[model samples]
Target: MTEDGGRRGRHETEEERADRMWGELIQEVRVAQTGVQILFGFLLTVVFQPKYDRLSHSDQVIYIVTVVLGACATGALVGPVSLHRLVSGFRVKPRAVRLASRMTFVGLLLLLATMTSALLLILRVATHAGFVPYLVAAVVAWYLLCWYALPLWARRRHPVRPGDRAPDLPPGGPGPGRRQGRT
Candidate 1:
């Protein structure tokens, strides 16, 4: 507890915090990895489709770019697992976790670009309408709002103060009305 009798931050050592964070990061990565891998696999088969040969040269270029971006996203999202395997038992969990988090963020950005380009190519081929660009832009804006804006807003609004307990945890102790039993 602090001098004012409020609960302190999570009672975890740096290593313990790193372990917890690594677990959480891996779970998040798993979700992204599945998505990117599926998208990448689909992109690979597109080139063999009968309709693919009929597409204009510019559309074909867009498809190629989208496929490349999807492959890059897949690599970045899966990099953390390989990193952990290579660094296991080296006593660098904290650093590994930070690097993994950065890779995941980059993966998300690549995934966004991949999806945006894929949508643009599909809409252009389907309708050949002048409004296709506007439609794609609207969808990208929605993705930004859902994936980035809301999270940043919440982080700024609920900045964690030093010595404050984790929000999900109870205020007093291990159990209701009981102080921590530590000596």
Candidate 2:
């Protein structure tokens, strides 16, 4: 909430702000958690597949690294839930939120690594052509652009100033034709 009735418009105390931030953070975590969990699940099954025995030594190592990254990502993404549960009644939600945010960031990075490793292994198995490495590099560049570059550019270019109020949306939704009442 901000001073001007915009986006998350409303005046809120420090505690209220923390609460709202926590809710938003949790929503974001839920999305990342689902993705990492599913990826980790698939990685786990790979080791038991008959095709696992046929991978080259290098490919096998890549698979192992990917599995480890997936595990780390899963742990980090789920860490915030454990952290919140442990700290719930301590009157330190603001601090907890900060720590959880770090954990989420680490989780996202690990997910990126896991994805890159998985892609490398898949491409290696799918083709032995000389262009495979170049292809993987291109895809990694795209991931970097999409996952890290754009958000950072926006953050740097359009930062919220200390006293500036963000534009607010209507209560029902951001625009007209949104459901105005209970449906």
Candidate 3:
């Protein structure tokens, strides 16, 4: 019941944008929440195992830190659900979306830390060779490259200027499928 009677209407306002953004955020949260929950569940079971006791004090410390980070990540990632529950129908969706986006961003950072530390711990325990740290560092670099660096480089390098034309072709151009002929 909006301008276009659907999602293709006028530009969304801060409030409408918030509502829309919230829906998008919820979808995003579903993916991250599932992952964080699975990770947290797995982390919870490690304490009961026998090899867990054999871990060095340092490894144990890393495990504890990783678990804490994973727990925090889960909480922050799931914060949007609680936030939506608390703020739904309050007529302040714009602010809620912004807040939830921030929380989700923080949650992603926490998830990164949790995963990194978890990887470090697993690699350290599974292979006591001197090259474990190096291997972990390489993997971390690859993650950073794939997750952040490549996108950043693309964004910076292929930026659109203010006067740049869009990729739309005019009425009968060589766009989709059109061979020149009669009308």
Candidate 4:
């Protein structure tokens, strides 16, 4: 604990870091879970609408697929909480965190697919023009850019070596201390 206080940059132990990460992950899940749940609920109601009966067979199929995707997205987004609950007190928090993170990523991907499908269905129903596919494709591209491409690009642009200290840490925050010359 050379002047900076403790081991890690934020002077946190392993458990402390895991705790912080879990908190952040939970907050993120809350936002995504709310969205997916709402979308799924709405999707569930669409079949009961009077207009649903007027849709062509192909459109009905698309609606069915979209609703299924929404349900899957909802499950994936809610998975992390279930994982945490089942694995609590198991003494494998780091591993649990990793698994939860993976679940969250999968959940986000599913959510993207659900959203794209829903948008495609909506656009098709709203307009029978030839531009619907192009429009949906453009929107999908935008979602990919926002969701994956930018984050990957930034990560590649600023690579961190294995032993490198965290950026958010201040100078002399936490690392091996320098040794003095022998007398």
Candidate 5:
């Protein structure tokens, strides 16, 4: 323990860091899971609407693809919970967390596709306007920017390196905690 009552900042045990990271990942996954489940539920009922029959064949195909994507998103977003349940107390959380995070990422991507397709189908049916494809493309671009680009940028900006390359530790100065023998 240091004077600040903090564990040495640069030296977190693997399990300790994993524990903290897992908490953050779980919170993120919970938000995504809730969204996908709700969207899937709403989608499941849309096909039964009387208006559904009025849709063109192409729009109906889009609807089916969108619904499938939503179902897949729900499965993937909820995968972490099932993974945890199945692997509880197995001492494999770091690997499990990595896999779960990948599942969540896939789920989010699927959710993005589902949303774009659903929006395209709905907009085409509601207005039959000429600009529907352009509109959908714009929305998808926005989602990519918001969900992927920004986070990727942030991650690139602030990377974690070992003590030598790490931000807080200055480069090549006899490493950390060298005492100068001055007169």
Candidate 6:
């Protein structure tokens, strides 16, 4: 039971919750990091390619922008690891977790932009067709749907209610959102 009289949600302390969430966040970041690193590596090599010299000025600009976006995305994705390394043993895991989460979110947004720009540049160079923009738009829309919409929909559809215990937790454990009752 909480001071506010609401039922506790989990049995873990703040630090414990932070530890669990930090581990999960790192795992998620690892997946994103690998992808962004690969993309950024490929982007970096594009300027050295023989065909790069034949690209139109506009295409060159687009390629440059895509590379910059990729670099930014990579930095943002890797920021959490640095944050943890610097802040470890500071007794601020909870705050660090929150900050890391925000960094990861920003990284994901940057990654989306990076991918979209890269796709547009690729298709433009490959086809030079009038429909390239449309095709890129469609792909960006698909990414938004898959990456953002579905998760948001599920989160909205099934929210955690006050007093509702997490499934994995044993019953009657004192935790956040749990009501305290007379013994």
lDDT of 2 by residue, 1-183 (tens): 344543332456546766877898899999999999999999999999999999999999999999999999999999999999999999998678767877988998999999889988988998867788889899889988987777666555664443433223244332322211111
Ranking the candidates on lDDT from highest down gives 1, 6, 2, 4, 5, 3
- Give Cα distance to truth, residue 57, candidate 6, Å: 1.0
lDDT of 1 by residue, 87-127 (tens): 99999997898788789989999999999999999999999
TM-score of each: 0.84, 0.81, 0.76, 0.82, 0.82, 0.85
RMSD of candidate 5 to true structure, Å: 9.1
| Tens digits of lDDT, candidate 3, 21-139 | 67877898899899889988999999899999999999999999999999999999999889889988888776777678779878877888888898899889988888988887888
Give a tens-digit lDDT track for model 5, residues 90-166: 98876787678678888888999989998998899988999999999999999999997786665556654333232
Q: Where's the lowest-lDDT run of ten residues in candidate 2?
A: 174-183
Q: Candidate 3 regions off by >4 Å?
A: 1-10, 154-183
Residue 64 lDDT in model 1? 95
CA lDDT, every model vs. true structure: 0.81, 0.78, 0.74, 0.76, 0.75, 0.80
Give the residue spans of candidate 6 off by over 4 A. 1-7, 163-183
Model 5 bad stretches (over 4 Å): 1-10, 164-183
Tell me the lDDT of model 6 at 108: 91
| Residue pairs in collision within model 2 | 6-168, 7-168
The CA lDDT at 99 in model 3 is 78
Candidate 1 global CA lDDT score? 0.81
| Winner of 1 and 3 under TM-score | 1
Question: Which 10-residue window of candidate 1 scores lowest in summed lDDT?
Answer: 174-183
| Structure candidate 4, residue pairs in collision | none
Residue 35 in model 1: shift from native, Å?
Answer: 0.8
Candidate 2 global TM-score: 0.81
Model 6: weakest 10-residue lDDT segment is 174-183
Cα error of candidate 6 at position 164, Å: 6.2
| Predictions: Cα RMSD each | 8.6, 8.7, 10.5, 8.8, 9.1, 7.3
